[model samples]
Target: MTDPIRIDVWSDIACPWCYIGKRNLENGLAVAGQDDDAPQVEVVYHSFELSPDTPVDFDGSSADFLAQHKGISIEQAHAMNDRVSQIARDQAGLHYRFDIQQHTNTVKAHELTHFAKEHGKQLEMTERIMSAYFLEGRHVGRIDDLVALAEEVGLDGAAARAALESDAYLPAVRADQEQARGYGINGVPFFVVDGKYGISGAQPAEAFTQVARQVWAEHQV
Candidate 1:
């Protein structure tokens, strides 16, 4: 029997494409019908902060951050975000309000994800964080906000708060960053399929489907 496919995804909650990439991956899995027969693939979400140096309370919108980071005009940044927002909407059924976006460092958010993983609710936590950032406009970089989201997802709110306050999962977040660097990854929404194939960006569902099938066949050796 073939081993279960292992998928490691490196993403950040603040990244719109990460959510789109996640949906595309799910669509691919559904199209492949691997859920019917295979010992379902194992998916692990890794931390990848797009704006590691962002302040806890960013003073400006996402446009401001992008403009500063890329050394471009606000108009150009807005145009770029608008295009990505449109693509994300079509791919993930997400509505990104760039104007309301609170650009903050996601390091603590990633640590909370690690805490969720310990409680076997990593995926749920991931989804909640993504939704909060993109759809609900929650302040993801704050400890209190993260604890509330954790409770909403059925995790221990106090524990989550403690983890954030004590920086408990900081090591796990660092490990993810080290792994990404080891893999030569320098971008968000990077996927490693079956621990062998690498897929980058918010690829088309068909592309993901093809990779899933290919990886499955190879594992069947």
Candidate 2:
């Protein structure tokens, strides 16, 4: 059997573009898979916190946070978020409710994804957490909330709770961050295909499809 093409993605759950990129990558893979002899692919998500110092219960809205973080006016932040939201809806069919988003430190959420990885539910957990945060305006920083999300993905809620409370996956989260640093990755939603091809930002589906085809063809030769 041919080896699957491995894709390592560094993204944060709080990143709007990361979610859009996720959908685009999926769509791109689906397009590539239309061929009967298309190579199989494997995706591994890594942690990259966009706002590591953000409080679990932030005192301000996402717009306020963005304004301060980017040195922009609150109105500008709102406008920017609106533009991105419109793009997400039109391009990826993702409904992002930035107005109701609960911005928080995503370390715990990242750790929860690592725990889910141990049980082979990492992808499902990541999707559920991102959807909860971006679409449902749910709080993902708290342990109880994360455990609930784990259960939603068919993981053992109690074990998840224990892991979170004890910080069992914290090391893994840190390791992922350290690896990101090693690669000099300063942005979220970065993709490293086969540990070499680097694609940054929320690129279109065609970009991913092209990379997949190129990498697979190179391997076959």
Candidate 3:
């Protein structure tokens, strides 16, 4: 019998393509799991922040941050964001409101994801964080906001708050970062399929489906 395929995904909540990639992976999973011969796939999400130096309370919008940091005009930033939004909307069913998104550091958010992983709710936490950042425009860098998001996902609000305050999952977050570095990964939305194959960017659903089947076939041989 072939072993189940385990995929480790390294991504950032603030990354627009991460969410799109996640959705594409899901779409691929649906295709891959259509037959009894399909390999059972297990997914694990790891921490990867795009902008570690961003302030918690940037005195500007997400577009403003992009404009300043990327050395582009505000109009150009808006155009870029719009293009991404259109892709996300058409391809992933995600509504990205970059204009109102809070540009902030994601380390704390990564720490909270680790916290959720301990409770076996890592995927749920990941979805919520990405949705909050891209769609709801929530402030995920703040403890209060993170705690609220945790509670919304059926986690203990007080425990989440305490975890953040004490930096309980900081080490785990760092460990994930170290692993990413060891793998020579320097980008977001990167997927490691069965610890062997690496898939980069928000690839189409068929790509993930093909990988799953190929890996399964190789394992069974």
- Per-model root-mean-square deviation over C-alphas: 1.5, 0.8, 1.1
Per-candidate clashes, comma-separated: 0, 0, 0
* Cα lDDT over the full model 3: 0.91
Considering TM-score, which of the candidate structures 1 and 3 is the better prediction for this target? 3
Over 143-221, each residue of candidate 2 has an lDDT whose tens digit, in order, gives 9899899999999999999999999999999999999999999998999999988899999888888888888887787
Model 3, residue 180: distance off in Å is: 1.1
Candidates in order, TM-scores: namely 0.95, 0.98, 0.96
Error of 1 at 91 (Å): 2.4
| Candidate 1 wrongly placed segments (more than 4 Å) | 34-39
Task: Give lDDT tens digits, candidate 1, residues 81-187.
Answer: 99989998887677888888788889999999999999999999999998888877789999988899999999999889999999999999999999999999999
Where is model 3 more than 4 Å wrong at Cα?
Answer: none
Runs off by more than 4 Å, candidate 2: none
Candidate 3, residue 130: lDDT: 91
| Decreasing TM-score order of the candidates | 2, 3, 1
Models sorted by lDDT, best on top: 2, 3, 1
lDDT of 3 by residue, 82-200 (tens): 99999999988888988789988999999999999999999999999999999998999999999999999999999999999999999898899999999999997999998889999
User: What lDDT does the true structure give each of the candidates?
Assistant: 0.88, 0.93, 0.91
